[model samples]
Target: MGNKKNLFTLAYAKKFLNKKGLELFKKSNQTRSSNSFKSLSYTVLSSLILIIIFFSSPIINNFKNNLITQSIEVTNNSKNKLENVLTGKAIENEQNDKLDILQIFEDIFQYEDKSTSTVRLSASTIEQLFKDTKYNLKDVRKNKL
Candidate 1:
């Protein structure tokens, strides 16, 4: 019984992978390569078709335009909503509340008034700082390029 089983196994192996079966396996491999090439070509062709459809289609252009217009509308809506909230709250409050809200927004947004602070530099102050350097104004005035 064991010998029969072994013989069956050997016969099965020879049917599929022996020298004569090797030629058949090689032919199948060739066909598989050709099949893979065909699939690759189909993939490239489909991708190119999709790209052409995406670019040349008016429906796609309209979709893109709609997306852009919708985004702009959304931004405008948000700005209007913010302004409405600020104005609506300010109208309900006293005059002090309006100043407080403005101050709060200025603090949050860091909108400092630059005109209130002035920096004045004297010529002697600048000359004293550059006394050790050749870039002093007196030296600079005498310098010729």
Candidate 2:
């Protein structure tokens, strides 16, 4: 009776192991396939992102630098033009007055921001004014170059 019980236990153990092994192999195959697909997809996406940035980075940087330079130049030109306008006015007034450009802007524009560069007169209209000023500055200097 003892030998018969041991033989039955061995048969049950063998059947269970075979079934579990097959299930484990199937699960591993599915996981491996999915992971491989995901890895390939990720690699392609990363490569494309890198390529786009590599191609576009220099152009974007150059464009940014050009705009900054142009803006500074425009600000300088505005300063000169504003000064000339005030001085010319003072000369025409013929009151022998020494005009101070900064004071004139301060007295006339009278905004509380207390900044020193060319200013947009009104907050709501600032963008269009800035664009026009920049464009005018560009046009003024275009012939000088």
Candidate 3:
């Protein structure tokens, strides 16, 4: 091992040129000689196809049209749902017409509900409402997960 000189430098490379060339060729052949040609061709063909699709005006226009149509569809669906809720059609049960904690406090403290139509809420009723809302919020979070 001591007698063998480190011949990796350019000046000494010529002495082991044949051995180094054989090793490099073996590595190259193992990696990308014949078996990888088909894969390389497929990659180039796919890249060209993608580039063409991206550059083609007709394809670009079609993609834009599809996006616009899909967005319009989503907007129309949400609009219809909002319209249904506004018309009271979305409310299947009359029990769903109750207010939440924030709404209850706002209505109570702010004196927003001046009408004699609804009954005034007591302290026990408020406590019960808080408990019910807490349970409902927990149930909703659990369902989401």
Q: Write the per-residue lDDT of candidate 1 for residues 88-142, one digit (tens) a residue.
A: 8432332433456777888867656555577788988777767756475666778
How many residue pairs collide in each prediction? 0, 0, 0
Note the residue pairs that clash in candidate 1: none
* TM-score, prediction 1: 0.25
* lDDT (Cα) of model 1: 0.69
True-structure Cα RMSD, model 2: 23.4
State each model's CA lDDT, in order: 0.69, 0.71, 0.69
lDDT of 2 by residue, 19-44 (tens): 78743223453556889999999999
- Scored by lDDT, the top model is 2
- Per-candidate TM-score against the hidden true structure: 0.25, 0.30, 0.23
As a whole number from 0 to 100, the lDDT of residue 91 in candidate 2 is 24
- Which segments of candidate 2 are over 4 A away from where they belong? 1-31, 71-145
lDDT of 3 by residue, 80-99 (tens): 67788988885333355665
Candidate 3 regions exceeding 4 Å error are 1-33, 56-118, 121-145
Q: After superposition, how far is residue 128 of candidate 2 from its true place, in Å?
A: 68
In order of TM-score, best first, we have: 2, 1, 3
